[model samples]
Target: MQLCEKYVMQLLGMSFLQYSKTPMNDRWRDKDVTVFTMHDLVHDLARAILADPVNNKGSVVGNGCLYAFLTDCSKPLQLSATSSANIKALHFLDSGKLELRGDAFSLGTCLRVLDLSECLIRKLPESVGQLKLLRFIRAPRIRDQMIPNCITELSELNYLNLRGSHNLSALPESIGGMKGLMHLDLSGCHGIRELPK
Candidate 1:
């Protein structure tokens, strides 16, 4: 796995990219070295929590390397490699809020599930649509950068939980366009009144 920092519009200094050298569906057994602030350790821990396939008690659980952490704040790089080169889940638990320190559109091309819970995210970048395989999003406070109508383009999405956004007012009409979605949780979106109709 390789990680890089790159400049992205709207974000000044906190963006990263993840890349892989092989095809997905393979196994990523080699772990890459990453540096984290003591304060940022939780972010990596969060990824480990989500990426772990078995319970610590020794129960075989979910499988997949969907969780990841950001090493650079400028460009995206390979976070890890398994037999599977594609990202299936992501656990971004950085204490810092979600401010694009770099290009918001730099998410890796093969990412799937994304977990940004408990982070400080106010808006999603217009480039979010680039995750063609993204099936899950856990941010509940993304209120800015409208959920691009382009999100409807993601035919693979299944779960969407926006349960604590107090300021969000409405869902993108395009949301109805996500035909593959199986579940949607908007329990905390206080201002939202109706689904896209």
Candidate 2:
């Protein structure tokens, strides 16, 4: 396990919350980190590594490691400018509303995990399919009626979640073609009347 010692401790803690499933091997990162309280850590986020809240409008915070949040996506937010290429995960905070530019999905080149379960965006950007290395996706409750067909191209993706997605009505026609898909969650998706044939 090449995961840093701190992240290793994090996995142990997440297991206590019934969040981290057992990984296949060292190469597989246990892909679940939910909000949980820990000693010295109030919840999932440990601390802010970088911040300039006073001048920053709405920042994407990452330190070539893990986790970033787009606090304000009232308009089309640009992630490419703030985030580094080495980030593994990105999550949107604030619980208001979000709108991301399609081109902004190019988060450097090495994003592996994404958590959009909180952001109530109008739609899932088509560019999301371009993140070919992504292994985990936790996007739920999107406002769009359909997910982009191109998302089926993510060959490394294993987990896709659309829990409580009230407006997401249809999945990609080629969903079954995702070679690495291991787990899919459709719980609470009220708009989907039938699964793709």
Candidate 3:
């Protein structure tokens, strides 16, 4: 079965877009690339539901502390330190390459999941390693960046996607020591000569 199908993530019957370039094909086979997306209305409703009044983070009940947010911020990106303490997720999939090398990691102490698709974050702060609860990270296309060795300290992290991050010459030496890491995607990373031993 397909990955989405296996995960039961087929949203609205059209929740995913596959990469298909073959011509003259009527039938759709299980392809390699699968990108998840939803209709604009679905996105709108999600934003509305996740909108927090005071913290400007995301929550199902608006006032509750399910704090997560979708951002499309520009340069000099930052978040409120006090408010980010309880935040759980932060998605920058829509935002362009953000240079989040500042207060974001230090403040977002409770971040469980973080998506930084194509972000310009060449390196992360040491504070990110301190977030013990971090479980997933989707940081594709951080080309030539040096992911901090501190990242391996996240013992709770289970999933990490770094596809298309070309020119990343090395991974943390202790990457294999991350016992909790169940998945690691390094597709299109052409710079690495070999996996860590």
lDDT of 2 by residue, 20-83 (tens): 3443454544654333333222122234324313335454543435555556444333433454
The CA lDDT at 172 in model 3 is 90
Determine the C-alpha RMSD for candidate 1 after optimal superposition of all C-alphas: 15.2
lDDT of 2: 0.62
lDDT of 3 at 62: 38
Model 1, residue 171: C-alpha shift (Å)? 1.3
TM-score of each: 0.56, 0.62, 0.62
lDDT of every predicted structure (CA atoms): 0.55, 0.62, 0.62
- Of 1 and 2, which scores higher on lDDT? 2
Question: Where does candidate 3 stray beyond 4 Å?
Answer: 1-64, 72-82
- After superposing candidate 1 on the true structure, give the runs of residues whose Cα lies further than 4 Å from its correct spot: 1-67, 71-86, 96-105
Error (Å) of candidate 1 at residue 108 is: 1.1
